[model samples]
Target: MSESEAGRITIDTSRPHPARVYDWWLGGKDNYPVDEELARKILAADGTAVRGARANRRFMHRAVRTAAEAGIRQFLDIGTGIPTEPNLHQVAQGAAPESRVVYADNDPIVLRHAEALLKGSAEGSTDYVHADVRDPDTILRLAGESLDFGRPVALSLVALTHYLGDEDDVYGLIERYVARLAPGSHLILSQVTQDLSPEGVARAAELFRRSGTPFYPRTLTEFARFFDGLELLGPGVIPVYGWRPDPEDVAAQAEGVVPVYAGVARKP
Candidate 1:
């Protein structure tokens, strides 16, 4: 595949970005000072912030593995933050060597790091798209080049959408993307929830706004609303950390919900 127009990407280091801040939270070196400052503030309120990022990554790993095992070989992962080791393609391709995966993100840092995320097994294909989640058409057009729309594809919007807030027509965006896929296509989503700690969530939301990134946490019910017309998977909508977890780590996640819930559903 041709290289994306990385020159078109603009990095505004004056303010913290969601991708870089999240990268810092995950303990990656791609983040900047502004990102670290905001991440530290969030961690001050929630000591498990780093653990939460790890859990979210683990959930992505499990979801991709489940999709690959279920024979879903094509993936369209939007809002794919900075490249981390064993990315979605790595997990899916490990389970199904021929899996075709497309990763998309708006951040220039993520685009610069796309080369690392593109590494895949010899039998699989991995590509990157520089686009925003708000523009569904661009993502669809770009992702379509790498994935087959006539077959089952997994659309992963992990740890995203929350950034869009309620006024962003989040559900409509999901429908726009999911409408292009064939039946049995999967919708894998993970979002922050404020049901357990509304006050802490509100504080975090304020921090994001002050950092120049508009983010709002959703309730469990609001988070589940995104799956209205789809068939939720077996485990159903649950905290990302607890969804089909191994017996050993389940209890540890129980102590702290991490204010995030995730689920996978299938289009009829």
Candidate 2:
């Protein structure tokens, strides 16, 4: 995959990284022992950790497909964890072969596996940016090389914001990113919430905090605020599995409720 100059890539196995922990939850082997340790701890605290990770992946697939079917060819996905199969670009290009996609993440391991993410349809283009979500300027500037902000681009940050604390200005950060999108662009988001399983979510957050990664599980009202000036689609801001579920998602719902809220909104 083509990448912007992000300086020397480094992987610190000394501590657990959110991306590595997420990869471990998704059953990927790219994570270190530290990541698996935290993943197991969180799973032990919350039985739905594995299910929640899978649900978020499915939600991303559906959301990207929805945007692609609606004629949004350009995509910018920040906080991309790892090179999972049927990733954002795969889903987008599956709907429209000419789709252009840019993936941004701070994880060095993701960059190491980025070559796998670049195997897209010949009709489309895929690029990766080794950057963090907190640095919107770098992400936007690098992604702009592959995507046109003048057109309707699909911006996705699925299951990512919960990792950012209030000091990160999460809401303001989202606004800054959204402000760059053109009219008809789509903003896709999914976040961890305590509204569904309060106790379990609380325990999980505590575990994350203890590991030096601050977690913020928002309530429904707080989560809804992220879509402030956009037009929410049908079944707006509901549980991850309930947002236009396919047969697979329908069966997943029977597994039990996952404490995550997801929504897709159009920039008017």
Candidate 3:
């Protein structure tokens, strides 16, 4: 759909955005040339970006399913990328039809695809907020309308925190939400890291910077800091492929480093 299709958001075809580039990597047709160009550059720099994206996607899927099985009925997913099939709400609501989910993203392309994202299960609820993660207050306010903060809510920040540079108060922003969550609340995340492939990771970051979308690749410890004080789930913070993977999937990811670290933790 074109930007004009959604009068609420402005489309900037001039520059590449994280969501659009991510969409392009997933082989979606909703991205513009700018996004494709940057995605190609990142791919050239590190042939594993596409693989990393797929690994991250699988991590999100697994996390949502596990959360639903763990009795999490509400989800607040920030930096929710494009409306990929079997999206977060779809996976969660599939497991628990009464699930309620709220998606927030700063990208205009995501806003344009928000309508599709709302097609959740009949017994479930879905809402979208065009807000940035930097403004945790705005996300909390909007998401609260759809999710009950008094109860446990799974906050999914998959493949997103890396975009929040060191200059951004990402830790503080995350802590703000963690503090507000109830005891059973969970933090689900997967981020790009330089632990395995330092050279490839640096090259990908530089490519993103050249494309005007600077991405920071953190170390494993740095990623773990985001979940400080929380109880880590089994398998802990490891490569997305290292998470409790299906036997067949584990064989698929045994080749090389995925360049992504992930984990699901519960707020005490």
Best by lDDT: 2
Cα shift from native, residue 1, model 3 (Å):
17
Better of 1 and 3 by lDDT: 3
Pairs of colliding residues, candidate 3: none
Model 2 over residues 193-248: C-alpha lDDT tens digits?
99999999999999999999989999999999999999999889999999999999
Clashing pairs in 1: none
Clashes of 3: 0
Which stretches of model 1 miss by more than 4 angstroms? 1-4
Q: How do the residues 151-203 of candidate 1 rate in per-residue lDDT, one tens digit apiece? A: 99999999897898767788888888888989989999998878766777788
Candidate 2: where are CA atoms >4 Å away? 1-7
Q: Model 2: clashing residue pairs?
A: none
All models, RMSD in angstroms: 1.6, 1.5, 2.1
Per-residue lDDT value at 84 in model 2: 89
TM-score to true structure, per model: 0.95, 0.97, 0.96
Could you arrange the candidates by TM-score from highest to lowest?
A: 2, 3, 1
